[model samples]
Target: MDDRVAGALSLPEDWPAHPDLSLALNRMGSFDWDLDSGLMHLDRPALDVFDLRPEEYNDRPADLGQRVPEDEGARLDTMLVQALEAGQESYGAYFRCRLRDGSLRWTHTQGFIRRDADGRPRRILGIVRDASQELADSVARQELDEERRRRTSLVQATSAALAHARTVQDVIDVLKNSRGLAHLGAANIVMGLLEAGRIHLVAEGPEGSFVPGTRYTKVDERYPMSEVLRTLTPRFIETPDDFARSYPELWGQISHLGVTSAAYLPLIAQAHPIGALGLLYDDRAVFAGDERNLLVSLSSSIAQSLQRAMLYEQEHDLAEGLQQAMLPRRIPEVPGAQVAVRYRSARLGRDIGGDWYDVIPLPGGRVGAVIGDVQGHDTHAAAVMGQLRIVLRAYAAEGHSPATVMARASVFLQELDTDRFATCIYAEADLTTGVMQMVRAGHMEPLVRDPDGSCHKLFVEGGLPLGLSAEFGSLDYPVSTVELDPGHTLVFYTDGLVELPDTDLDGGMRLLTEMVRNGPQDIRRLADQLCESVDGYGGEDDVAVLLLRRDAVPSPQPGGRLRQHVAQNDPEALSSARHMIRAAVRAWGAGERADEIELTADELITNALLHTDGGAIVTIRILAGGERRLRVDVEDRSSALPRRRDAGDAGVSGRGLMLVDRLADVWGVESRGGGKCVWSEFLIPERFERPGRHEPPAHHELPDRRDRGGRDRGGRDRGGRGGAGRERPGGDGAPREP
Candidate 1:
């Protein structure tokens, strides 16, 4: 049998079959190859499937080839070539092949090669099936599923618009205008809450569109919207007639606003009806079920946002209370001063402004006055204000001068490392002297209102605000001093009282002047009047006030006026010390140690001139009352700290501290700012005469009175009587005994 023949022929060879294969010659839907002739044949159905005819297949052009997509066709051709050349058993694959009609179709081809007896391929045969429709349907189904996934993703993306909403208004705004929803409608959303019996507008969308008037009052008993809100049931109407039938009273208002339909959903926050949301439309058509579902979902988000907003309000209240407690409850009493104070917080929120004032008492019957503002408007500012106030009191109590007090406080503020800066005014006044001195650290100067209605502003120069200048050398604050007249009031306050937008600072000062001139006389009344008058000024920043009065002159005491006697130079100082030391020895009844005490006094005078910056002046006085002792005081400006020298110095280099410590009954150094002083005192002797200017009694001395000059000797006579008896142990290896 020929390899081109199958079991039977279903069609004639000349029939219009596909041109590439012999369908009529081979009726069976299979292909065969003749190993000897190298010719291939397919049955009728196989030829028809591939669109080839039996007559045309035999006379087909030698260059005619199956058309397939490049990658798949290349793979299939490689597999078939290997089977034909290498005598492989069979190969099969699905690939896209082009038909003679210029259309492409997918085919499944299974084929084998005929081999010669020497194991070499002589011909190849195959059969192909069209599977194009099945492959196209599978791909179409996968594309449809992918499109559905994309729609689901778009719906999930809408959730982000609601993420930033924490209030009913916020949610409504997001639903209407956020996430590109503004094109949905005119973006008009209204929020209402039930108060006192009716639904009152709490917030409205497209702001300023709905002008809430007297028609929207809460006490209205017959408003149709109020009834729907009170019932907690959702209501919908799509036309004027429908609206009248469902809510007769609201129909007129709705028609006036051109609203043809509306959906009302009750808002329940934390399980209670706080308000309701109404989605409105301008057309008469009713909304579908899915559109209503979206509105209902948005209502739930609004309810959650309302709950969070309520929580935030409660927390804000707590913070406000904490800020208020940090300030002083009331002004304090200063003996010779009048005080006043005021504080205000922001009206709309829990922002407590930082303004404070305090009047503190000090030793020596003085008072410290302060007014300051920390740079903020919250709990942190109030806290810093409290810390500054406490420190001010402590520093004032330590007997610091006005300038010193402010300078020290600036250093303290720099070390605190707070995030904000502060401006303060520190002043100290003595009740007894009627003298007022103040220092301003970048603060407004105080105003002085005299009894005669004259006003004056006290300004300080050359001081920086606290925390700005961190160096010690830059901390030199100047003090302003004035002799405040009797019945005058000094007013210290924060800038809030006078500063106003668009008004120059000088104008602010002038305004304060006018306020004082026309204000009340009582300090508390005046302070209240000024604050109330300036409430709208400067955006109502927090204000604080402090008032002070200089007291009347005090009565004088006895012995208040004593002549001061000062002696400088080494010789004059030593002579004064000896005279004073002799009087103390005689007065205290320590006659046995009179000579030693006098020698010690001489050493002290010489030490002051040698080691000190200059030869210091020494003063001597005798007290008739209050211990009745002689006194010697040395004043110097040296900054070095005093220490005791060892007693082993045979020479006279460092003998002052040692001798003074051993001889005086008590001794110590008192520290003043920038300097120190070493002071000591010895008990007076009873038998020793308080030395006169020139002489001492002859019976009290047993040695030569003159030192080879015929002048009175080391020990002078009480009555100038010559006692020229024996040579005394002098400075050149001489000793004298008392």
Candidate 2:
């Protein structure tokens, strides 16, 4: 007998059992216990039954507790309490406990009590026995009972993987990592995909176990495992010797790979075998019945995981690629501005993020910029982002204000079929006026970094995200303005970069401020730095940033600035006629064009001021083409036309129009808005001769001066003859002198 077992069988020195009682106790494996104090006095038979020593039971519950199952600790404590209270004359328990060798055995324990006349328990007796072997048999049966359940789950998972996997390669990958469905040997695992009817080896596990990229022909293959897949049943190759005996020609190939046994399970999809799972074993161990059952069960699960990932990947690629292509190829140059941007996803899943930015040129020398984030991370989100981008650009091009654009955009986005929401900031800046207009949806306030390196947020009140309010209120989003001083920077971004998990909004804003503070000055450099920093801060969503710097103003010099002429309505071939004024400016020189153009424009206005009624307003614009040339336009609000009299008979007033017609390169007039405007231009003298320079004759200095007075005089006679041309202020009289 083992010495430990013998010692445990020994009796205590003081309460040694008598020969007769020892025989009885050994036969019955009986013991006595005082539950209140947790004392156990076990007979040698009972102690030996649990492989415990006599001294271990001396007021010690540890010995019995050692046998209690970890999961049953609470139940056993309650049982002990009931026994101590004498609630029942007898009690019983059954549980697993550890033995002397650290092996566990299930024991069935029963106790009986001897009570006094008052029915109070005085003494308790118990019996214990080793039930380890019996319990093992019970567990084995229970495992068998659960086999059907596990198989069902595995099949369902595999079916799902198969249904979702779109590509052949993805199908194989899905099967590879499908866990818990089979007792697959993690070692020597390889996957072969069927592409274009050819078996191409796609993946293998246990690095270097099999030559990668190896291909094998499916035709004329004597693979019982592969053959069995056609029937959708698990195929088994019990042993290499058996395979050799059954198919000698193919035995050498299997033996060379040290294949001693194998099983091929069919990966079925929609009642068809899309592929076969070939599991190879290099040892001679026969496939255990349970393991084969487990493998078959798990095959379906592996198939399903593969299917899901593949489908997701396909949609992700298409949606994400299209979204990126729709984005601007590069930031445009706003000569005086700096720009930066960053984008990322909050989740690991496919196409879940839809964030975008755009810079557009607006009328009246302004630039429009927008940054918006879509609410989801899938193809739908990306699609919506693309749509919104297109709509915003078109609306801006149509000359809508930032606030109007956002207001209309919300309606457009809400009408989309997809369930996507967005937050955005729309801003426009008039470079000529230094005026900036901005409207924000429910988005993080943009950061403004002044030239002094001080950063502040552009927080506007009364804004909400798009797609939330059914009847989007007039994008009452406050439009804020700030002077975009030269060298100062404005940054717009999606909230993703600043939003940390569970952090307060203010804290996130502060962190973003710090990031911008530490960022580089150059737009591109700042963009890259912000991306890296936000990622480091554990940014959970896609981060997008757009930075703008107002460029320094260009110095004013000849040919550097645009020039314009303003004029007014006319009568009798109005001296400030629109066409004539435009033609004159076109012929005039670019240098000092501003002064010359303004004077010519003022003369036309003075004539109209002296002639027309109802407050005539006229404007002329000189569209400069180059350093020496320009095009001109003039407009006025008078319907009554201008008149011209003979230059020889003209007075100071008539001389003004004749002098203008003679000096300007060209002059004319046409009806405008609700009236007519006449205009003319005078060339700026290039070089004025000194007082005693002995200048050339007037006729030689200026070629005939166009002789246009005769044409105007004739036009006045014709207007007087008919009623076609409206009369001037002094139409019936001769010319007025200034």
Candidate 3:
């Protein structure tokens, strides 16, 4: 027997056999191998380690090669053979073993090899210790280190994404793309703002949450969001039960949504809670402390960005409101013409500009159209524009010609001392005669389309812009007149329409004219197309366009007349006249003007009744031509003709004839066989007309003056030498002395 094996098989005389030692030895199973017989012997403890029955292994020694794993068994056999052949005292190897129960355990074996005199191995003794638990612990530590590095990288990426977010939606999109949050087990994310005691959902990621702009009352204490807002802290709900316990009413809804866990953090800005950020998980998940801290920090950055967006929105709304208020509330219903106007602001974050257009009702049935662009786009410029528009309207309404209006507006703007200039084009159109007169002040020329669908720009003479030096003289604006045949159109616009950055003015004008010429004939459709064509061309300036189309005459109606008898003293005659006018307008397919026509008819019939003692005859006629006209005639037995009187600031009664003068295209008195007739005409708007019709001259040509000390041949005083044969005040075919 080997000396080491003999010593392990016998006990020392004074050895104490401690229980702890016995237990330790049992945990480490012992194995003995007989090299000559090629069999292995395992003790009771070793049989327990392999889960083998004692009777099975005791009668037949187990195969050591089959007991260990194939590769490990090969390694152990080689080590034992080498040790015995070299006469080595001890040998050991670490390997995996598969027990009879079909489970694997890492085992390390060490033993003393016993050999004969020639160093041939006869028997082997070894102890097997299971090392499965220790090996598993080492692998887990390595995986944890790798996960930490990944999480750190994700947090850094998320921070960079949030820093560059520009808008509320941008911030939400960045949060939604957070791979780190998904890796850390967040399934859904939502961003909301608290306003007016309510939570407003601003953005939802990956999938929609409820609906955008969804509102929830913050006073509802049962909601987790409400609690988060109240406490201004972060909260983690670990399970459905936790949610149910805290919010019984909301538990059913939340459970139906399959949310097993959630985290809610308040979005704080400027040290105040503005809103809340939320993360939801379908499966139960626990958030680590560092992950929660990262989310909290992200919430702060998002809140700051959101606050800025909100402020910008508020200011945008205010600026838009101011601009809208300064524009025309409604386009006036001009006879024989259709007008369409459009205005668009600059891109977001830009101040509202002072580009404005107006359609004002001028005296003598003419319409005044104006478009102007101020020097700047600030609030000061907008204010100046508002004041300037009011002043222009006042001047135009006071019966001043287009040139006079432009000159007066320039003077008025200079008086304001705003230190800003503006370019404008003021035009007056006489619907009855199809004549349009315009005056430009350092502004673009008017573009006109003939009835033949051909277009050309009117190179009207222009003076200095308004608000410039006041030394440019009162009559500086030169008026240009053009005859608009039926179906003709006139376009007036600001520089924004034809002037782009680094682009030639001629090229821009050509582009505009081509667009207008090929555009639809309908005023509204043409306006829309023109605006769309130049939608993105105006870099920083605002765009404004005003279009006017001369309507063509409709086919004549069979019998378009309504007549009524009025008693001189009866008050019902006025009402009867108004009823007749309304019925006639409706029959003529011009019911839109029923209100204004009825009011005018009432005034005419009342004047006849108040001025004469005899009953009068009232007639309403809808004239059919290239331009339809509504003619109202009131005849009384009195020879006195209606006359216009000066109605100063406080005079209310004299405004009757003044209203007739301002509202009607033309009003005059004619002497009939038995009475004096008072008549007023209103041109009805037409849609289409026959082409190739010759346009009438705006006014007859006047004889040349000899310049005899600024006197005509008849020695009559010539008006300021501006132009000969200027349009008469009433826009009648006759000429008046200037």
Candidate 4:
């Protein structure tokens, strides 16, 4: 070799090359690395392996390690040091090298360690081989494996989150907040469901991507979600241009959101497409086959879960509607008694169970409490429960005994042709006598708590459940009687109270007896505590409870009388009568019925003014007794009696008398020899009575001044006719009684 060539190659003149070694070195690139001097010499083949010119090669041996990738260079240095320390004759290393063009190439170096005279390492002579293609194939396989692992993890997390959702909104919340979707590179996630022929957006990620509940016509071809629903296929949009071309109408909106790529996958359940799932990305995204397949699989699970949640939500709403329509609006207020009722549906069922309770005010100031349960927990059972309740209420209102009401209701249920059986317990309490009569029909016995807080059950003899047999005439439900003394309580309930899953009838009854014995004194608070105590066990059946406590009777107030004066022929007395009646009823604490009483008084007063020469005298008497009565009387000098006339719908005048008859509990006409006094009595509801309110002074009794000709001797005309009657309003025609 010439001096310049040797200098460029960094080679010595005495370098030895055996034939076998020379042949091996010729095929692969050879290099000499100096251990102490830190100089390197490369052959022409070695220079070509690095893709470098001879002039570009640096003489420093450390420069070769710098040419390798940083990580590989560190590894190579470790391997060289270990080999030299072990005094090995040969050592090899494979490393990634950076070429002049800044590209990576996998290179393998095999060298022999040359030792000095003292057996210490001096230099290394090595051959370099390019392994770029082999390393590239290995790296591709590793990348594919990692991608698969990531996809699998995402799918598992998504399925788990969706599985726990119980409602449609819950599913929406999961999709919007799941970390798995974000990890999978989703910037915006939107879910649209087909509802009533329109695609409605149900859920969105990162807020503002799509408005929830925004609707689009399913038939519109420009909407991507609608298209997915129509075709039941997936769509992958690679760029904003693709979205603009496919769905021009929505492109403006999508572009404004900075969405560059999107994927719309149809969510199919039970071989039908119900909705679509959309994933959007701000940057360009390309989905590979594996990723696409993973998304499709995830969508299938999401669809089924979402469908279940939606169905549950629909059924839940329907069940609630049925319950609200059937249940009583408010419990009736019984005198000397505090009543409370509670109802709870089964926790683990799809159907709304047939549990019902009712408080009916029977005649003679008595209250009837009814509690029952149908055999099933379904919409049909609930309907039957409502119907059965109405029938029982009608029978009780007719003043039938508890046993007779049960027998009649049983026959009614059988005749209705409903394929369901019901267990019931009905009880009637006489508020005046503090006596209770109860009857059971295949139901649990009534629980009673005495004034001393001692509890016991009344094991009344009961017949078969309603609708169980056609022998209603033979079925005799025996009535059991118990005295509800002052501070005593009576409990009526269905089998759900003492038939828990974990406890038998005896055990449950004992537990209930304890709870009631130690319960709060307030009827409402006791009802709540009883329900919470028993219902904490996750009951399998619906529960219904009715609690009635007879409080100590209050002292009666003195009777109050209100009298309003009316001129013999004054038309303005009608308004004055209404005002007087309203004020009297309100002061008596019967304000809830004030409107009805005022109307009734106005009708009677107007009738007297229209038909009689002398105007009517309006008297309102508030009686304070066991059952309070509000009596309104109108006495006039007319002999004509008001008869009930069949009034047409459009005729307003004749309906006044009809309203008085319908609104008043009892009404009659009393003739005091001359004039007739028409009186109407209204039994005030117990809720209106103020317990400790003072009463007004009683009024003096007025003598009967009626004559046989229907003209009152005291109310005879004293020159108060027509114009004169209007001028002397407070004169002879004025009210005589204070």
Candidate 5:
């Protein structure tokens, strides 16, 4: 109520609220330092600036050390010295000064130098003020700028990551796992895609906080996600009570999660809401000012990515359907063998591949298993695979030999109008005799698992891939034969099953071998387990697996036969034939005559290789009559007739006829086209004849050596040499002189 006396300008009682009184309200003070006396004089406000009481003050600047930190005081002295030396009229600085409670307060000072003629001879006058509020405002501005930069960085990182998302799951993975989303300050993320008039919740927040029936709700429903979608607007939630009041359905279920705030954004692409995105925060208030705009922009980006991913999935599904149709519809039940087949599509990208498998039943209880992959991963590769599979199956079913089938398939693929090539492995197995001949075309080696659960790689010499071999004129695929023992499993697969990123084929093969060894004993279960392992790896390539397990079959009796191709001068081939004879004679129930059968077969094989032009095929079989008999036949390309030869103890060669005649019960020679067969037979012991199988038809013909057709080509038999076990191959013909 007081009024000022006459200068006649009257101010209200609250004078500090006036704009002109701002300078006084700033808490400013002044001081005078007399350099000559090294003493300072301060006003009442100046003592207050230093937080010093009147009784604690002296007329000296050094006494202010109790108020100003030592470092800050030195800084002020340095500023003064520089001002005086530079002949400056003014100087200023801001520093921290201590208060009576021993806490720091920001202070500012500006000084004017009064100098004499020499400039060094001077006194200083300065002002000091409390600057805590002013500087605190500046610090606040810096913090806001930092937050802005972080948001900008997050947006850029999220956009870059979403650029590579080619599938819907990929987009979800980025949102849940990417570093950008992790730094968004969101505790968890939720997402829902709109399909068929409903919101399908694809991603949920936290462990299990998803509301019960709210997962798939209609657009008109009273839920936050539904509200955002229905209005095509962004919903920014401020606090826990605000959330609970607005959307009690969602809040009740999620309140236990400590979610105080949230943002539900309408994911709109092309003016339509395709999905909704929800960001959950715990114990925080979110989406103020530009933050709401940031969420909207983020939702837009997510919408575009989701749309693109869905489109990719649609196109990929169509291509993958074509791939499945091209693969074998179903593996046929094969006699004498159990078959399991599987094909998995590529998971990383939208492209479909040409990995495939097939099971073909051949005539005469034989079966063919095939595994192959075309060159590229696309619709074109799948098309080529379909055509190639058809042609390969046709050729195999045409009674072609394993090598012939592969060679013809290679030629056929090259002749096709496409530029694709395929790597493949084909196996032709005669279950009756436990003999399988394999042909490889630049494919991965097959793995054979024994009955005891140990596995090893079976390396067959191979030519170039189908199309490439024909182009390069190297179409001679080697036919490597393996005798499948009862309960042994032959594993055929494409490279995709073993190949992994950054790993070599050798390492991959080792891992695959271990997996096969440890897999379940049942072939079907094992096949599923193998595909499951590949699935868990998230492999980039498509895979196909074919397992043919020979069921436990009785030993070969009258129809039992083993065939092999022995190249000229191939010592290894001669030795393998001998070992087979020994194991076969023992397994055929000839206990005392195993050695005689093996030795006689060795002499005939040695004679054929030593005298033939190229190589010979050896066939050993059990012939049923009044007595069980084991015979050996060596058929070479050459038809030269073989006769008895003499060799004394000193002679290193010959004596083949003497060995054959002495060991065999009956020995003879028969002439056939392109070859002559020298044969001998030995009477197997009575106990060796098997029940229900000892009698074969009178015209029962053995499969030919090369084409493997049922034919009675003249057979040359070798009598017993000391050998043992039912065992397992050859061309039939006469013995030749060495």
Candidate 6:
């Protein structure tokens, strides 16, 4: 007791001499493995670390499987193998250990690799310890870091969604529908916009949570939203009692909703409060510091989006109103045909377009159909469209030819102060005669639907668009005369109808053609069908459509007449003239004399074009006298009279005067204005004048009106006019077809 240092130590019976005493105190143990023999040894402390008694584990590490989970043991083996193969000096890992109670506990093992002098791994020395206490402390920190990451992700997701919101309502929808508020433990949301010193509630929390008097509340009112808006600061309610005490007026109504807590944040943008947002939680009673900060940041993002959306909607409304006002108010009912028109605005905000359609009633039983789109998608485009529409209608009303109308309109657009140009297609349709004079100005081809529901596009001679034609000095839009047989439909549309993302023009056209063929027969229904089809393709651009279908049976009383302008060398114009005559004859019940009348009319038209320097204008009408004769007149600008002439039998020449005199009951020539009218007539039966039936006689298969008399429309030259059919003059009768 007196003195030696060894004698002064206080040791237990298992202390100083026990090798594992120090390791057991620290819950650590050692291990030794013989790699070549595949055997391992664990000291008493190591065996305790694995929760195995002395008899439970043998020298083999595999015997420790009763305490160490199979997966953990395999992981330890893999770690040792990798360490030995690399000649690593150390390795460590934490794995689950099975305890005596069948509960798994975390355990860690660190090993040191022992190598032979030649560098071969001979064995591993290591220590094993229980890591449950070490890992428990870190678990709390991990949870905190994970929460921070989730909140950051929440802000990013919400901002991304708000960035696409284009209206105030859109911002509300994102909050309600995108689960942005749900992540914050908010069962529902309430939002209010500040307007005119008042709070206008845009969203009233969850379903059936609307407060009776809170929809419109004053800034001084006893409401949470109003309080936040007035103070421009966020308010956090800790509990239902806190909400009830702070604002008893509002809490009384929402108390039944089981809202235990809430956070009302002022929506401030650029230092100005524009609105307020309320996040109501049905279960939670308090908001953490991080939750409060996150909600504040989200409020800032929502404020910015709401302000942007509000501005966008305001501008969109003004521009859309301007566009609608500029367009035609209504389409009038056209005689002898069914007409339909439609328009759809674009999907983007403030992208109002200049697409427009109009139906103008013209003189002489004719009507003007117009479909056009100006160059842009803005207010300026709408203004230009309005001006162009007015001036165009004025020119057409003045009885100008289709080509002249388009040319003058082009010049007008060129004179306007705007740099925009418009693509337009103008058609002057003679409903009674089944004829149309089409002029295209840098626009898409018009589609024609046959009686059998076949669709095809017309390739008319085209000039530059409205403003461009005058700029390029190419105002001569040649006229393409088209024949619309009874029961046929003419379709005019802006490019929007045939446009789709990632599709070429031809593909779009094919899709449109197929839809038109299968669409409803009625013009009104067909127009609706086409508009519905546009919705499927994502209508990024505005569209305007016009459909005109000729009456199946054109039955006009007496005084029904049709006229066409024939160009000097344009076969289409000439053929159109013939169809005009043919349709008039059959429509007015002169089918019996159709052959005789058609021959006489052709001879006179050929004479007018060949003998004169200019083209001729042909007019056919049913004379309303007791005789009920059908009259035909071909007028030219030349004042010279047509004199009867003779041709030899071998002549490809003028017996036209003799043939007309034979076929027509009366034929004559007279000078009028600065020109002369070569006239012919055939007396139709009295029974035909009454026309008890709507259709022509069945025996006569009406010939093709496009190209008749073995003459093609594309031919540029014809034999001399000295043929046997040539005419100089004849008796007092006009040439026409039946």
lDDT of each: 0.60, 0.61, 0.70, 0.73, 0.78, 0.82
How many clashing pairs per prediction, in order?
A: 31, 51, 1, 3, 40, 26
Q: Ten consecutive residues with minimal summed lDDT in candidate 5? A: 720-729
- In model 4, where do residues sit more than 4 Å from their true spots? 1-167, 170-189, 204-224, 230-232, 236-262, 269-272, 279-286, 304-350, 411-420, 432-434, 442-738
- Is candidate 1 or 6 superior in lDDT? 6
lDDT of 1 by residue, 172-286 (tens): 5666665423333423666776655656676554433464362355633444446556676666666767777766655554556767677777777666877777666675467
- Name the TM-score of candidate 4: 0.47
Judged by TM-score, which candidate is best? 6
Rank all candidate structures by their lDDT, best first, as comma-separated numbers.
6, 5, 4, 3, 2, 1
Candidates 5 and 6: which is better by TM-score? 6
Candidate order by decreasing TM-score: 6, 5, 3, 2, 4, 1
- Per-residue CA lDDT of model 5 for 1-738, tens digit only, reads 234444567658885464324434578878888989988887777788888888898898878989999899888889877877788899999999999999999999888888887667468888888999899999999988988988887788888899999888889888888776666678888999999999999988899797888778898888888999888888889899899999887788888998878889999989888999888988568567777777777778889999999888888788888989998887888867889998888874457788889999876456889999999989889999999999999998886767778889888889996889999999877676566778899898899999999999887878789999999999767767667888999999888878887778887888789999999999889989888887676567888999998887655557566665667766656665665666566556675676666777777777777777877777777885666878888777766666545577799877776666555555555566777666666776676343355775221232122112211133322222211110111323333344
Instruction: Enumerate residue pairs that collide in model 3.
Output: 553-626
Q: lDDT tens digits, residues 1-738, model 6?
A: 456877887868855555577788899889899889988999989988888888888799778878877777888889877877887899999999988999999999998888889999888888999899999978978989988998999999999999999888889899988766777788988999999999999988888899887778999988888888878889999898899899997888888989989999999999999999999899897788888999999999999999999888889888888888988898888888989998887767888889998899986678999989999998889999999999999999897878889999999999997889999999988777666788899999888898788999877778799989899999877777777878889899888888888788899999999998888888889998898888798767888999999987665556666666788888877876777677777767787778778888999999888988888888887776666878888999987766655577787776777677666655566658788788777767656443247765532443322222312234422122112223334323222221
Considering only N, C-alpha and C atoms within 3 Å, which residue pairs clash in candidate 4? 568-615, 674-706, 674-707
The runs of at least 3 residues in candidate 1 whose Cα sits more than 4 Å from the true structure, single-residue gaps closed, are: 1-320, 346-348, 471-473, 551-738
Write candidate 3's Cα lDDT for 1-738 as tens digits.
Answer: 699897788777747765435634656677777878867777666666555667656524434545677787777779877987778889887788787777787777788888888777788877766667767887799787877777777767776777666457767777777687778677878767888888876655334346322456564556777888988889998888888898786665446677888888898899888888888888756777877776777677677777876776677678878887888888888767888999876545438788899999865456889999888877777788889899999998887657668888888888886788899998776554455567788888888888777899877778789877354564456655555666788888887778766678898888888888888878788888777766556455677889888787444453244444566555544554554465456546555555556766777777777767777787666565655878888888876556556567986555676555445555566667777677766666664242344753221121232243434445645333111222223323222111
TM-scores of the candidates are 0.41, 0.50, 0.52, 0.47, 0.75, 0.83
Model 6, global lDDT: 0.82
Worst 10 residues of 1 by lDDT: 556-565
